[model samples]
Target: MTTISKTRIDGMPIGLTLALLLACAVNLAVLARWL
Candidate 1:
């Protein structure tokens, strides 16, 4: 069984970083299309 601890902010940083990366990629794509 896998147990996840919600008390730590460990996973949040990684998840946020990935989300930011994806958002930046999408923004870049849009800018490219507009150019």
Candidate 2:
């Protein structure tokens, strides 16, 4: 459901936004498991 856009900042690809979001989700999952 995510769309990668051609426009970007400082040459970084827009697709990375989803990757960052997923990384946050994984971090939360690990935190939940630890808690």
Worst 10 residues of 2 by lDDT: 1-10
Candidate 1 lDDT over residue span 1-35, tens digit each: 13454434345788886787799999999999999
lDDT of 1: 0.75
lDDT at residue 34 of model 1 (Cα atoms):
100
Best candidate, TM-score: 1
How does each model score on lDDT?
Answer: 0.75, 0.71
Clashing residue pairs, backbone N/CA/C < 3 A, model 2: none
Error of 2 at 6 (Å): 18
lDDT of 2: 0.71
What is residue 26's positional error in candidate 2, in angstroms?
A: 0.1
